[model samples]
Target: MNSVRNPVLRSFCGWLTALLVVASVAFASGEVRAASFQPLEIVTQSGVQVFSVEIATTEEEKTTGLMYRKELPDGKGMLFDFSPEQQVSMWMKNTYISLDMIFIRADGRILRIAENTEPLSTRIIPSGGLAKGVLEVSAGTAQKYGIRPGDRVAHPLFNGH
Candidate 1:
């Protein structure tokens, strides 16, 4: 009788464990897919001056940018999206590469430029205390490409409003 009871209990436990495992996997996958579905694009400068940017319009996205990533391709960058034009500041915390932070106004005009930010530095890179959008690219990319303050960033998103 004792052996029979033990066998039944073991089987029940195994079944319960398997169900829990399945539930956990489903939950984890849902989370990963949600975060992976962000819309990103590679925009080029010149005609309209578009660059690749990972949309960071929300608070959550602005916080977790490119964190833990080892490398970023050329002409690739992150674009911080904002609902309204406001002064914005950025920092290089846990970031691995030096970058040129280009601040843009609501009209897509380049407002200010912060170049060569040290990797992992916690220093606050202010956007001249007023900016509606911010773009991050490899250090010197701004200069090499002749991107300068007063240059307009052409994008449909920045069309006259």
Candidate 2:
């Protein structure tokens, strides 16, 4: 009985080890990572719209913001924090879905809205003025939700929460 149980335990351990190895490889290859989501609000003239956005604060996360994704559902987005309020440039290199890039000031005001950007284009999308953050949402989100410049953004990253 002992010998039979020992062999079963060894096989189980081997299978577990293989699973862990595969998972580690996927993570190391940058193909899998947990996303951090937070609540964000846009106060438009019409009303306030809420979104559950993934925050990209780390350099690696910001560099790979929404890239390779097939779709971004409505009411979901990615927020990039570029603290210190400087000029920002973005491109759609590996991004497969069209997006609306909303430039935001440090004071949480919407500075500019670049809507309906072409997907997978390398063309530089520049923030016309200094900005502290940028929100990338599904194409037509600005129009559908009445989001515009001078609108207020309520997020923890911005001033006044």
Candidate 3:
């Protein structure tokens, strides 16, 4: 009975170890997690443009924003929340796709727009004024949607909504 029980315990331990190893590999490869997306809208002169944006609220999420992604569909984006409306800086390190970074004020007004940012660049993109959030979308998105400075953004994070 003791010998049989020992073999069964060892087999269970081995299976658990294998499962942990696979999980570790998937996490290290950055393929095990899916981003959480939220609805956002921009009211421009043309009309209201909607987007499904992933909110990056935590330090870790902000640090890893869109890194290693191969593509970003049109009307999809990531929103980085830096509350209290302070000047923020961003870079494209490890980012595979170019983006248009929209700096939004605390009142949900667009402060500035950095369009056609180079991918994988380490150059610092600065918000010219105080901003509470930064929205990153595919390159050329702003031009296609007629997004401009002073446009209103409606989301739960800002006062516009």
Top model by TM-score, which number? 3
Q: Over the stretch 53-126, how does candidate 1's per-residue lDDT look in tens digits?
A: 66666677788565545566667777777647788878888777788888888887788989888889888888
Model 2 Cα lDDT, one tens digit per residue, 12-92: 988999999998776555454326889999999999999999998888888988877778899999999999899999999
Q: List the residue pairs that clash in candidate 1.
A: 43-50, 43-51, 43-52, 44-50, 45-49
Q: What C-alpha lDDT does candidate 3 achieve relative to the native structure?
A: 0.91
Give the RMSD in angstroms, all C-alphas superposed, for model 3. Answer: 3.9
Residue-level lDDT tens digits of model 3 in 21-140 = 998876556443335889999999999999999889888788988887778899999999998789999999988899999999999999999999999999999999899999999999
Ranking by TM-score: 3, 2, 1
Candidate 3 segments whose C-alpha is farther than 4 A from its true place: 1-35
Better of 2 and 3 by TM-score: 3
Q: Predictions ranked by lDDT, top down?
A: 2, 3, 1
- Scanning candidate 2 in windows of ten residues, the lowest lDDT window is 26-35
lDDT of 3 at 14: 85
